[model samples]
Target: MEQELFTAQDLEELQRRGISLEEATQQVEDIRQGFPYLEILASASLEDGIISNEPSQEERYMSLWERYLERKDASVYKMVPASGAASRMFKMLFSFLDADYSEPRTEAERRFFDELHHFAFYELLNEACLRNHWKSIPKLLAQGDYKAVVETLLLPKGLGYGSKPKGLLLFHRYDKVERTALEEHFVEGALYARDSLGQVHLHFTISPEHQRDFESLVARVKDCYEEHYSVRYLVSFSQQEPATDTLALTPEGGLFRREDGSLLFRPGGHGSLIRNLNALDADIVFIKNIDNVVLDLYKGPTVMYKKYLGGVLVAIRDQVFGYLRQLDKGKVSHSQLEEMSAFMRDAFGIRLPEVLDDESLAPWLREKLNRPIRVCGMVRNEGEPGGGPFVIRETDGSSSLQILESSQINMADEGQRQFFEAGQYFNPVDLVCSLRDWQGKPFDLERYVNPKTAFIAHKSQVGRELLALERPGLWNGAMHDWNTAFVEVPLETFNPVKEVNDLLRPEHQA
Candidate 1:
């Protein structure tokens, strides 16, 4: 009776995870009550929220960013979400292992086997095959033992890539060496995110299980990259806190439990990385996905555009900071307030609900300008599957630019679906974010998160159906209240390796 719904053991587990029993119980209640769909105003396009810069403006913005870097006043860091396992990349091959036939049956299977030699991991996998079956990949294939080669490549007897993170998997090939996705991030950080002090700080949000592997890989390769790039690299890692783990629901819509009778929790998705990002001691932080790396030949556009986005933020951030400071003086004229309002609308796509007196406007200016800001890279939709930029009406009656995923939108509403279909740009998770406010104080990022943006997902555990909650997405709900800006980036700058075969794409190949 004292514990009520939970046993004393359950309370102990909650304490171990830094989660309160009330929070845990409320999670179950929230899952049952469900999160409401966002109120949509319209899609963010070049005509409104998104900034479509001209080709000639590129030099100006890039130069502005270069000057910001040379100023050496603000520090920059890069945050990558790399904890995801590479199992999904090999989903097709996993099916092959269980199929009735030994030989390639599907077109994807044939393509994978045909292009196997072109993969960066080919030679290493071949060595693994030899060690496991006493035969090379070619010999194994000739002998009609494709599964054996796959087992050697995937299982512990070989590279163990099946259990490894994408960051550790070899993704690109060179004349003399191969580089993993993590290594590519090092190169990219040096190219764009480096500060004038010749330092580049990168933080990876990874799984605890993979920490030792990451450390070993970094120790073996960090020095070489630092020497080659002529810059010191400060690499760090953090596991998603167990406190951020959300409770899962059983198929029947009750609190889910494991076979051993312990409560079940799942990672709160990338949104949980916000806590990790908040811990960075940087003024500017670049966020990108781990699987978005490309060969050096294709990195020029990415590097250049990254600078351009940073420059855009630098210019806007300077203006916002200046306004915030001016408002602190409390003597801004009506004309000055009008200009501030115009800039807010033009630069940030924020519109106040109604007119206010100068006394009220000053505080409004300070409130709006003093917040975390992110310049997200939006690309032509090209019919990609991901969140897109939109202008959503806020609770305060103002409309702010946002990136909404399908799960966040109410597609059943015709008007909302029309707005959804109207969006032409896609969020590539390429962002240059300002982490500190005008007074040089870090923002308590959690204060800006829109909890209503959290998502419910269907999942399975040991043959039982379950529901998992993905905290408001990192780019979507987590940053919902931040000052948002969208910039168009090139389609070429958006290559992602969703599948293992995607490595065969020209962007991934050298």
Candidate 2:
């Protein structure tokens, strides 16, 4: 008798997608057991996990970063995850489209229409309305036909902005021109990511459907920025790999199937980007989300702090490399081992697991120093809807700095909820990472991941509720064992536009 759980065709399909039968079986097992919630020992604070620097220390880090940029062999790149669509940003507007009443019923919807002219895309929306509906926006507003204006802006007949990626949408307007989030990131890269040869390297993880649009936009604006900044631009794009897509399960834990009896697979979340990041060939990479940008006027602190984080990374890497060289020689004294242990605790927030005899110390130090390093910028939380920073004890009994989402926490536990609510800092997805080892070799990033950290989210497909598995988040579980450091960056450094109304904030304005 053959197994009916997975047929020969199913096995062939799995093999074609680079997924093994055992891996598929394990995924099924994971779905059965469900993901375990993360244990919260305590919230990482200014006193323990977060690094707050004085002005003098800031200057030193900046100088060090500039020196690192000037080094001949150094290669720096910026990676932005720009795959999310703008549908969520316009959720309220969509609701307005569906309302039975002629006018908006809620304060939020009324505010959107009352202040619609202030949006960066207002002119484009007006033009779209005039072109498609043969009616100008001002005329529609005069007649109290606000829905027509919104329809032209969001529907396919007009701008179709509701279906577009957030990166390509106009986010900020200046006297001369309006800029998209993608354009802002290009400007940002020129300011901080340029290397010794006056060249900027950038890679964007975009949806496959929007790759051509992104490429065309890059081509259109690259020359303008290059001329403006006197620097060459090398831009690249990647899509989420289909193989990373996870299987969906029905409400009863059975395999989800389409009407045609085929399996259902959904794109893994941002965690899948770890594979994309691992494939990049660079010494240093700066990772940030697409929407976390600001106007040029307020960009000074953001750019300054970016360099500060990079400088801190380079300084720490230099010391770690030096210590690695000393360990390689195998002539370290007891006091020297103690020094390395102290450095590990102070720099990475990791305590050496059970000190052994002298012979075992050198290998342990080498192993610890050889992994990839990342320095993340954390901002003080102010009622933001994002993950918080924490010190979590791993399965191996080693504790390290981690960025954790609220979903991962066991909110049912009173003590854990207290610590979670008391969290003082939020992860802004601002990171400066060193991917190369002391020997100048790329560290295999996949090895450091904690598979247990994968998330199973509740989602609906084809009007049916189902469970979806998301790979561990890139910063959260994806870099689980990397040497991590957290620096407290200013709130100004963490301006992200989660909703359309967020553009009304001062940071997004000219």
Candidate 3:
């Protein structure tokens, strides 16, 4: 009977992972009941949840951010999610690696080989091929040994790029050198995240296996970037907590077990990085994906918009903190309370239910004001695959801004489907977040997570199909209960290298 759920060793393993018995029980229950579809009230637009500032307002916010950066005590840091292997980026190449045909077959495969030398990593891959196989790429092509070239780039005997993280892969070409996605992030951090102390702090969530490689890469380039930009670098790294790993379930919704009768667990997705973000002591935390960095020529707009978003955050935080202090001192008037409510509605996209009671207003304002605030940059929807910002009505009859994924929505519903399709803006995961309260205390970010927002995904391991659980996404349910704002940003500020071909785009080619 005990073995039906957990054995003694299983219990010990759960404890070691920091997962409580109650949490495990709840996860099993979730697999059984399934997560509820998010109710979409409407898609966030320029006239809805999104804020599109005028040229003058944009300038003012940029100036405010510059002034805020000049404050001696201000702290800002950039957080990048860079954990996963780059296996997906090499999906086509992997197919070629296993195919019966030795030469390139498909158009994609042909393009890869035809333009192989155009890649920033061309020289490196060529050198790896020669070093590992005693034949250069040109010689291999002359011999019609295309697989040899790919194997040299991907296999352990050579560059081993197929198993490497995207952050370490060469992405952009400069006149003097090639840069990885990680190095580009350092440049961007120096441009915008540097404080009055001339220090740029950055944290990356990376796979434990690649931590040393990432550290070495940073060590190799940190000094050069620091000297080039005249700024000090404070870099840090973290791995996903084993405790946040979710159990894999069988098709029958039972606990999945390996051949050794041990349970299978998978990483809990980017949402788990909330724990890493929570651990930072920064006042302003900028969250961006590791693969979203662009070439130096295209960084100006991205840097400007980053500062603009941060400026908006500081300006809003100042007003909210002042109102919270007034509420703390019991000096707030009825008119001031109304003004606060208006600010929440207009600035935060929070539509509260009608409340006439004066006593209840102070605590309510304090509760809302004391939470974390994030200004997410939304771009014009160009059919990119990511969560789109939406305004959803909560259980309390209030409505708040949220980033909802397709899996979370009931696409079967005509109205919800229409709203989803009608969305004009897209979430770029471009966020400028404030994690401190008015009293200068760090918020317990876990408290704001919406547990019901976890995802159930179908996956296969070793030819066995299973249902994997993913925690609420970092920008979606993890920050669900926080005050949210969406500001319109340029499309140029949102180039993400989702595919290897994307690197060939003009933005990355310099």
TM-score of every model versus the real structure: 0.97, 0.97, 0.97
Expressed as tens digits, the lDDT of each residue in 326-403 for candidate 2 is 998888999999899888878887765665788886787788888999999999899998889888776656667889
lDDT of 3 by residue, 1-510 (tens): 334688888899899999998888888888878998888888998888888866789889999999988998899999999997888988989899899999998988988888887899999998888788788898999999999998888888888988999999999888879999999999999999899999999999999999999999999999999999999999999999999999999989888999999889899899998999999999999999999988888899999999999999998899989888888899678899889989998888887776657788778878887899999999999999989999998888778999999999999999999999999888999999999998888999999999999989999999999998999999999999999989999998999987777777889886
- Model 1 C-alpha RMSD to native: 1.4
Q: Give me the runs in candidate 3 sitting further than 4 Å from their true place.
A: 1-4, 354-356
- Candidate 1, residue 72: Cα displacement in angstroms equals 3.3
Model 1: lowest-lDDT 10 consecutive positions: 1-10
Alpha-carbon lDDT of model 3:
0.90
Candidate 2 weakest ten by summed lDDT: 1-10
Q: Which ranges in model 2 have alpha carbons more than 4 Å from their true place?
A: none
- Tell me the spans in candidate 1 whose CA falls farther than 4 Å from its real position: 1-3
